[model samples]
Target: MKRFVGLISGGKDSFYTIELLKQKEYNLVALVYIKSTDIDSYMYQTVGHEMIPFYRQVLDVPIYIIETNRKAINTDKEYVHTLNDEVEVIYDHLYELQKKAVFECVSVGAIKSYYQYNRIKSVCDRLNLSVLTPLFNLDQRVIYDAIIECMDVVIVKVACTNLGKEIVGKNLNVISGMRVDNWCGEGGEYETAVLDAPFFKKKLRIKNYEVLHHPEEEDKERTVFFMKINEIEVLEK
Candidate 1:
């Protein structure tokens, strides 16, 4: 079995990728997370990131949380190694982790975003680590259904006009009836957080939270809904 490091964004896709990796018989050695300071990062998920550390307790793996200023210096389809780009920061962190841990592959959950997949692939290439994207080209609807069926996920953010703050903090099933282009939020229509999953030793419980609405500056008609979780707790299953 190949030892691999999984990337988690506190979202369903990334965490679910770990489940797929397990199914493939990969030895998950560690977890890496990029905590973006900017919520609107072009390359990473930023919502519900505050609760990421709790995943260590649920999965029983060492997690490395790296902070990025969220500066997407390189936006081209093909990535080039650069010092100032956020991707370089990821490469640097992984490079440091390699010295302490032995992992040959980096697992990602990029379903449709080539920009994300490409950048991560570029970094892994430089580190001599293979990239494992289990959900790279799978059907979004099927993935969405599987996640809803096997995981306890909540809508933590919404940016589309069709969605509102009412959906925040609610289970993912709430949006199943609604019409949306990307069922798995591939196009950034919304964001989710996984509270419980089949492989988790413990589940997360949101103890308290408040809804926040931020209207888009470019388009005043559109508002982004966010669930600001003030408190969260981990419970035995």
Candidate 2:
């Protein structure tokens, strides 16, 4: 079996990519997570990332957590090698891991963001590792339907006016009936975290949490909501 390193962000798309790769007989040997200092990073997800450690227990795999300042020093359509860029930070971490263990490829879950996809591909190209993106360019509605049907996902963050604090901590299924800019949250409409999935050994239950609202400074009509997970428990599936 070909060994692959899975990039996890504690989000629906990244986690779902692991499930897709496993189905194709890829060996998920290790997981990599980037802890960005910037909460609003264009290249990474920072909301609800504090819960990422629990995923190691759920997936039964070793995880490597790296920290980045989340700087977009190189924002060009084609990425260039720069030490300060967030993408280079990812490359540096993966490069070091490759020396310790030889993995054939890396897995990603980019749906429609060519900017993200291209940057990741650039890193893998330099490392001589193949990039596997199972969810690339797929229809958002189709992906949303599949995710809700197979996994237990929760809304962790809302950045659009159409959604508010009331939507926080709710199941992803609830948003299906409501009108939104993107079904899969691809347009930054919202963000999600997986509580349970078929590949997980256990499920997460949020015992206590607080919803925080941050109104946009320039746009009074828009506000961002986040579900701060104060307490969580692991349960048998």
Candidate 3:
């Protein structure tokens, strides 16, 4: 069987990529999570830092966390220059996952962002591995519905601009129509992680969730909320 490594961001796009690739018979060996450095860090199209561990547990996959943090550089050209440094750091860790023969393919959750997708493709070229993106060309709306239909996802963090306050602890199903369109559930408008899904041996249960609102005080900006998970319980099936 051909072995591969999947890069998971614990969101709809990554989750959908995994689902689609599995159907195509790729031997998924491990998960690669680019751990968040700080809120200001690139976040690699992800939301929060705390959600990584939970995603690993639910998927029952051994995760390799890559600390992609470095000094800040704002411009697109500067960002790409820094990316080379970050990819080197991650490649060292990726090498250790399967020491004998490096991963044949590196799966990413890229959609419409050419910058993001090409960055990963460049890394694959350097690492000598194929870059697989299952949801690369799919319509965003279709992918979002597939996630809602196939997985048990929960909202965790929302940027302080959109519907951040009302989403804390609310399951994705609650926001079905124009509400999701407003948030761009597939994009990086908000961030989420999976608690349970069909492939899991057992479902995950979350308890003691607190809704935290961080209001922008200086210039009358919007207030965003975080679904702080004080406690969680993973029950057996």
Task: Please rank every candidate by lDDT, starting with the best.
Answer: 1, 2, 3
Q: What is the TM-score of each candidate against the true structure?
A: 0.96, 0.95, 0.82
**Per-residue C-alpha lDDT of model 3 across residues 1-237, encoded as one tens digit per residue:** 566788877665676677778778877778888764555444353453456666566666677777766533433532343544544555566667657544589888877766567667766676688889877767777777788888888877676454656876778766675455533344455767676666666666677777665544445565666666667777776
Residue 4 lDDT in model 2? 96
Candidates sorted on TM-score, descending: 1, 2, 3
lDDT of 3: 0.66
Q: Measured by TM-score, how close is model 2 to the native structure?
A: 0.95
Error of 3 at 128 (Å): 0.5
Error of 1 at 137 (Å): 1.3
lDDT of 2 by residue, 115-173 (tens): 89999999999999999999999999999999999999999999888887799999999
Best by lDDT: 1
Better of 1 and 3 by TM-score: 1
| Alpha-carbon lDDT of model 2 | 0.87
Clashing pairs in 2: none
RMSD of each: 1.5, 1.5, 3.1
The lDDT of each candidate is 0.88, 0.87, 0.66
